[model samples]
Every structure is written in C-alpha cells, then in structure tokens.
Target chain A: MILEGLARLGRSGLGTLERLGRAHLLLAGMVLGIGAVLRRPGLLIAQLFNIGVLSMLIIGVSGLFVGMVLGLQGYYVLAQFGAAESLGVMVAASLVRELGPVVTALLVAGRAGSALTAEIGLMKATEQLSGLEMMAVDPVRRILTPRFFGGVLAMPLLAAMFSAVGVLGGYFVGVGLLGVDSGSFWSQMQSKVDFHEDIVNGVIKSVVFGVVVTWIALFQGHDSVPTSEGVSRATTRSVVHAALAVLGLDFVLTALMFGE
Target chain B: MMGMGKQRGIEILVGLFMAVGFVALFFLAMQVSNLSAAVNSDGYQLTARFSNVGSLKARSPVSMAGVRVGRVEAVSFDKDTYEAVVTMRIDAATDTIPDDTFANIFTAGLLGEQYVALEPGGSMEYLRDGDEIAHTQSALILEQMIGQFLFSKAGGD
Candidate 1:
C-alpha cells in the first residue's frame, strides 16, 4: 500500500510539473501583452509611483548603511597600498553594477512578494478568484498582470535609488568622517561609471527580478488550495522561491553582462 | 465595515508615504550627481602608458602629493606599441607634471578600487597633452602583495 501511494504521488508530481510548465508559458504571454499595454506613460507613471517611489524608505535606509560599510571596508584595504583615494570609484562601481540591484531585489522579494502571495491566497480562499472567473473575467490578466507590471517597473527604479543612496552613504563616511577629500570621491566616481551601460544594466536587472518575484508569488498563490493552511504554505513558498530566484538571476545576469 | 475602511485608509497612507519618499530620494540623487560632476570639472588631465590594463578602469583618480588632480578619461590598447594607453583629464589649476614623472597604479585599500598616482620629477620639461609619462607602474593585486609580504616576513623570521 505504501509503495502504491508513493507511485501515485510521483505520477501526480509529474502531472503538476507539466501543468505548471504550460501555465507558465501562457502566463508569460499574458504578462508581456499586459506589460506592453501598461507601458503607456500614464499607467507607467501610476505604477512607478506605486512600486518605485513607495519602496524608497526601506531601500534608502538600508542603502545608507551598505554604502557606509563599503566605504569603511574599501578604505581600510586601499590604505594598506597608500591608494585610499580610489575608494570612491570602487564603492560607486560595485554599488552600481552588483550590490544595488541584488540587495533591492532581495528586499522586495521579502516584503512585496510575500505580501502579494498571502493576499492572493486569501482572496482565493474567500472565493474572489472563482467569482471573477465565473463572471467571465480572466484573473491572470486582471489581477496578476497589474501586480507583475508594477513589480517589474518598480525594481529598477528602487535599485537605482538604493545605489545612489549607498554611494551617498559612502561619501558621508569617506569624506565627512574618514577625512578623504570629497572632491576626489565624486570625481573618481564620475570617471569610473559609464552612465549609459552601468546604470542601464542595473535598471534592466531590477525589472527582470521584479517580474520573476511577482510571477513566483502569483504562481504559488494561484495553486494554493482554499484553506488557511494552504495559504500559509503558499506564502512561505513564495518568499523562499522569490529570494532564491533573485540571487540566481543576479548571478546569471552578471555572468552574461561581464562575461567578455 | 468601519474596521475595513480604517485598514484601507492605513494602506493608502503607507503607499502615499512611500511615493513621497521615492521622489525626495530621486531628487537628492540628482543633486549628488550634479555635485560630483562639478568636482570632476575642477580636476586636471594627464596621460600614461602601461603594458597591461588588467582591471584598471576610467574615472579612476590620479593623485599627486596626496591631492587628486586628474582622472582617467579613456583606456585603449596600442597594438603596434603593445601597450595600454590611458588618457587622463587633469585640473587646469594644478601645477604641471614634469617630464620624468612616474605613474603608479595603486589601490584605495585592501580589496578596494584601483587608481593612478603621479610622483612628480624635478625635470625642467613639463608634460603636455598627448605627451606620455614614460615611467609607469601597474596595479599590485592584493593577493600577490599579501603573499609576498607573508613570505618575506616568514623568511626573515
């Protein structure tokens, strides 16, 4: 009997995977279509406000400390070589290229992704999703699409802000407290950063991360059974999956971007 | 119904606060970028040649006498000469670099950023644009430096 049950579970798992794969493709297409439509300036503006602007407080405060720590650590290492002025360039480049987007994505995954999963799960449990479907409305297009776009739009802007704040934090420590010349710090940063590529790459990474986080959350929420226990499970899975996806995607993007 | 209304109001307020904060932060970032640009404008220009570019990057500062006078503008490899050519923009107000000046690539700290430092020479001829500073040193990677330092210390012991 145990053997039979295990076999049944295996078959069900495969069936679920197949279903999820198909659902993912459909969802992807829908998300892309909705994203294109929402790219309209007015809608984008609303989304930017919802996703990017609102996330600044957490990003900023965290970024400040990140920058300070980077400055402190970078300064110590550079001091040994009597080359401390390069601290500005080091801090700026690292913040722009890697730290900014990765950190912001992780933070968003924790806060927004979890909330989205839980909210959707609760709505599903309360039969709202079913009600919408019965009314001939596509839940994926109406509910998931808006959230997916919002998250995708917000990640980059928030990441950029975090990086900027981080750099400022480094500046505060390097110039104000550490006695490194402020002029040197800023000049070094401007020289090192290729505003076009580095900044754009950061933004692009954030958008991708945002989409991934939203998709994972929605997927988990939609699949959840209509029970409180199921909702809790979905919430936990969404957060875990979103965080891992962020880190994994970051690595892949970095490898692709800097491979040459 | 009243409880739900109050909860919704709180959510809206939180959202509004986030929006306001983002705008304020973005404005601040723009100001910082402007300030950095202004600072860069005050620096001078200098050029150097290296055999290897390694991880050297532009916007890396050029310091002399513990003061930053310039930053790297461009990095390119000279195929014919088999050298890495780095052009730097120096602050106009700074004193001129002499002919025999030595350019050394150094780090800001351990695992920190790399930069070029110019040690001025007492030569009569001053460097001009397009003129290359003859003596140049490449960046000393941290691992290599630490390894050497440890080896030498152990050898002495």
Candidate 2:
C-alpha cells in the first residue's frame, strides 16, 4: 500500500512538472514567432498606444506628486544636517536609482498588465484564440507578439518620462517653493548623478520589468480555464503576480547590478 | 470597434509622447547632468593626484576664483603609487591657470559635496594639456577624523 501511494505521489509530481514545462514552452514559442508578427508595424503601434500612451496621464501626474513629496521630505531631512544645498542630489539619486523605474513598473503592471490579461483571457474564453488557430493563423504570433514587443518597447520610454517629471517636480518644490538655492539645486544634481551608473541602470531596470510583467500577463491569460470566472480570476492573478515579480526581480537585479 | 481616424490618432499621440520623452531625456542629460560637457564645450584635459578622492566623481566642477571653469572628466587609481589620478577638462577659454596652481578638494557646506577648488600661484607659466596639478588636498572624511581624534584623546587621558 505504501509503495502504491509513493507511485501515485511521484506521478502527480511529474504531472505538475510537465504542466510547468509546457507553460515555458508556450512562452518560448511566442518569443520565437515575433519575427513573423513584427513585420506588421500597425498592430505593434496600436498596442504600444494601449500599453504606454494610455498610461501617460497617470504616470505623469503621479510622477510629479511623488517628486514633490521627495523634495519636501528630502529638504527637511537635509536641512537638519545643514546640507540643504545637496537636496537636489538626494532627490535625483533617489528617483533615478530606485523610485523612478520601480514605481513606474508597478503602476504599469497594475494598469496595462491587468488590461492585457483581461483582454487576452476574454478572447481565450470566447474561443477566439482557437478560432484563429483553426484558421491556421498562429494565435501566439498574431495575438501575443505585438503586445509583448509593445510593452517592452514602451516601458523604458515611460520610465524616462517618470524620472524627468519627477526631477522637475522636485526642482519646483525645492527651488521655487522652498528657499533652496536654484543654482545649487541644478548644479548639485548635475554633479552627483552619473549618466552611465544611475540613468542607464534605471532604463535597464524598466526594460527588464516590462518584459517580465508582460510575460506573466500573457501566460496567465492564455493558461487560465476557459470560463468567465476563470478569466476574471486570471486577470486578478496577473496583476498580483506581475507586481510581486517586478518587485522581486528589482531586488535581484539591484543586487546584481549595484550590490558590489 | 475603433475607427481608422481614432486608431491613427492614438498612433500620433504615441509618437508625440515619444518625442517628448526624448526631449525630457535630453534635458536631463544636458541640464540636469554633466553628460553634455563633451559636446557643449571645447576644453583641454589636466590631471591631479590625491591620497583620497572621497565621493569626488567625474563631472565634479573644477572651480577657480569662485567661478566654475571646468569639470572632472575621469578618475583612476595608480596602484603602484597608491594614489588617485583625476583627469579634468578645463574649458579652452579658461586656459590662464598658472603652472604652480594648487588644486584642493573643497567640501561644500561642511561635507555635503566635494569639488576641486583651484588657487592660482604667482608663476608666470600657464598649465597646458596633460600638465599635472602636482599639489592636491585629499578629502577629509569626518568619520575617520573623529575616530583618530577619539583615539588620541583616550590615549592622552
């Protein structure tokens, strides 16, 4: 009896492994099929609009507010040490190195990622994915490729917007609102922030986050059970998973890139 | 379904967004950082050595007479000499620096930021490209000084 139970446990474990492996294969297939889909720029552009431009207002507004807040908090703390002149360096470094890419990724994962999962999940539930497959049109190529490339391409651009706006916002608050010297605010930031070290790393972070978030979104949508409830559940799962994945990957990437 | 006009509109918006994105990035590189010092100014290079650079980095200003004249271009270490080699890009217009000018790493606001402050000497000769600022004052870290001070006081007591 124990032998039989052990055999059953091993079989189920193997089954779970096969399912996970199959999911990876599906993602790989979608990745390989990008060349065929990318020939059509119209689809890619439309998806880019959906993923990035639609996110413009929220990212821009939040970026400004967050930057202002950073300025205020940074000034108060820096002033206590009588180093208010270095407030610009503090704000810019904090935003570019840590806040800008990570926060932008989290926001994008919430808005664009969830929308993608829902759209793709609904299509799968409605048999549209299979319908395309039946017509000999590869759904992964036609459906997934554009969204993946769009998300990946748009992410760095959005992150740059967030950083730029945040920096400006900090400038307004620190220099305009507060009594910090305008010259020092601008010069200190210029002197302290390294283009290669801080800015380029931030872009790399956003691009990595974009790829991972979209991959999770597309995979969860395509893998969910074919029902309305299943689609909704997958959509919810996509947002949660994408957020966690972005944060976790941010930590790992930070350790690898900046740690030592 | 969205109409063709609407789809094209969205594409145009994305295009505009990207254009602005580049502009913003340019502003950051040019105005908010010293990355554009290469393209924006014609400058000659100089080198200085220090025992400690502290937080001094590339693009830190090299000021003379309380006016900004140039920027630090690169920094490296001479392992054999056990000293830091700092390369500076002095603007072509500000080429009157004396050969005997002393370069001191000055801490702004009692330890906020560090820059090389150039104090000119009475020497008639001017420094040229590849000329070394033989005199350099390394950064004074507060923690190390405090540790030394505490140790000396305790020993004295």
Candidate 3:
C-alpha cells in the first residue's frame, strides 16, 4: 500500500513539472506576441524613459568602476609581454561582449525588478488587481505591459552606457596614466572589433534579458497570497528568480552566439 | 495627503534625475566613437615584407621616430617575387621617408599586438608611392626570441 502511494506521488510530481513547463511556454509566447503588436512610439518612449533615464545613475557609476578594474587587470597581465597598446582592444571586446549586458541586467534585476515585485505584491494583498477586473479593465494590458516594456527598452541603452564607460576607464589607465600611445590604442581597437555585429548583439541580449526579468517579477508578484508575509516572500522570490534567469539566459545566449 | 504628495514628488524627482543621467552617458559614448574614428586617418604608409603575418592585421599602425605616420592597408604575397608585400598608408603632412628606411616588424608588448616600425635613413631622395621598401626585417617570433635568449644564457652558464 505504501509503495503504491509513493508511485502515485511520483507520477503526480512528474505531471506537475510537465504542466508547469507548458504554462511557462504559453506565458512567454503571449507576452512576446502582444509586445510586438503593442510596439508604439508613445509606449516605447515611456518605456525608454522609465528604463534608461531613471536607471542611468546606478548603471553609469557601476560601469565606471568595472571599466577601471578591467583596465587594471588587463594591464597587469599584458605588461609582461610589453603589449600594452592592445589594452584598447581587450577592454572594448570584454565590455561589448560579456560585461555590458550581464552587469546592466543584474543591476536592473536587483533594483527595478525588486521594486516591481513589491509594488505588485502590495496591490495583490490589498485586492487592487481584483478591483481592476471588477472595473472591466484588463490588468495585463494596463498594469503589466507598461512595466514590462519599460524594462525591455531600458536594458539596451544602459548596457551601451556601461560598454562606453568601461572603454573610457581602460583608456585612462592604459594610455593616460601608463603613457601608452593613444594612436596604437585606437588602432588596435578598430582593427580587432567589428562594431556592427558586436554592438548590435549586446543590445539585443539586453532586450531579451529585460523581458525575462520583468515577466518573472510580475508573475511572482501577481500570484502572491493576500497577506503581509506572502507579499514579503513574493518580493524576495522575484529578485532571486529574476537574477537567476538573467544569468542562465546570458550563458545560453553566449553559447549560441560565440560557440563554434 | 500633503505628506503623501511630498513623498510622491521626491520619487518623481529621483526618477527624473536617472533619465537625465542616461542621456549624458549616451552622448559620452558617441563622442568617444567619433574620436577613435578621426585618429585612425592621421598616419603614413610603409611596406613591410614578412614571412609570417601571424596576428598582424590591417589598420595596424606603422611607427617611426616613435610617431605613427601610416597604417597597413593591405597584405599580399607576390607569386613571382615569392615575397610578402604589405602596403601602408602614410599621413600626407609627415616628411617623406628616405629610400633606405629599414622596416622591422616588432610587437607593442610581449604578448601585445604586432606593428611595423620604420627607421628613417639619411638619404637625400624620398620614397614615392608604390615604391617597395628594400631594407625589410621580418617579425622576431616570440618562440625564437625566447629560445635564443635562453640558449645564450644556458651556453654562458
């Protein structure tokens, strides 16, 4: 009798996992499709403003320090070979490919993603979402779409800022302080990096990361139980999930892009 | 209600500050990209003959007297001559390089990028465009340099 019960529970657990996977795919498809149709000048402008402008201070400050560190580390290794001029190429490539998108997404996930969860969780606890439904308003379109689009739009601009600042920091250390020739620095960068593909790829990754992070936050928040403790739990879960999603997606994208 | 309104106002102000900060950062990136592009056009050309191109890429600067005058524009092998000919573009404003200027392929640092350095000669005439720099030195490959240094030290010991 115990063995039968255990088998039943195992079957049910597998069934639940399958259903959860299907539901996630359905949600992703719906959000992406709706986002495509709803793309508009006003909506985009609002999203850009929320994501890019409002989050710039944090992103810029962090990026500046990251750039400085990359320069310092790259110099330590490269100076052994007397190849310091290549610092520009190293700095530019690292910023554009790995650091820019990943760092910006992580930052946004921590700051905006957490705030989004808290706000939505509070609304759920207060039954505000139910009130919207009673008033004949589409909560998905009205509430979730704006925040989702806002994050998606903000990510690319922030990543670009990070890349640029990182390069500048590298230049300050590699050229200005170390006395490496400026001409050599710029030449190495231009020759090695393809601006079109590398820059565009980074931007695209940021957009996808933004969507994933915002959706996870909103999903967790909207489903929270109607209690103070539930709201707090939801907020914490949203941040943890969003951060993990960003990291996992980054690895997947990198493999797809750079993997031979 | 007044206190709530004040809190909301503060939030809006913080948001506005973030937006302005992003705009400034974007402009900064644009400026740097422009600066790098402009600096690339200011150098002169010198042809270097090399047995192995290795990591030596085009747009690689050619330096002389510790100043960059041109960039490596193209690299091709002459089938009949059996020599690797690298064409470079020198800055117009710079003084003409003497015909006997020796070209040597050297690296920026130990593991850094490779560039061709020209040592100017005291000859009267200048090298015209398309003129092959006759006195050329090949790149001192890292392995060879290290091996030679080690072998000499070991022989002394």
Better of 1 and 2 by lDDT: 2
When 2 and 3 are scored with DockQ, the better candidate is 2
* Model 1 bad stretches (over 4 Å): A1-16, A32-54, B1-157
* Model 2 lDDT per residue over A66-134, tens place: 999999999999899888988899888888878888999889988899999999999998999999999
Output the TM-score of candidate 1: 0.66
* Candidate 1, A55-98: lDDT as tens digits: 66788899999999999999999889777788888888798789
* RMSD (Å) of each candidate, 1 decimal: 6.9, 3.2, 6.1
CA lDDT of every candidate: 0.76, 0.87, 0.75
Every candidate's DockQ is: 0.11, 0.66, 0.13
Score candidate 1 by lDDT: 0.76
Ranking by lDDT: 2, 1, 3
Chain A only: TM-score of every candidate? 0.89, 0.93, 0.87
Candidate 2 residue A77 C-alpha distance from true site, Å: 1.4
True contacts kept of each: 0.02, 0.66, 0.06
Per-residue CA lDDT of candidate 2, range B1-157, in tens? 5698898798899898788777767766777665765465578889999999988987778899888899888889999999999999999998889999999988876745688999999899999988999877888888999999999999999
If both were scored by lDDT, which would come out higher, candidate 2 or candidate 3? Answer: 2
**TM-scores, in order shown?**
0.66, 0.88, 0.66
Ranking by TM-score: 2, 1, 3
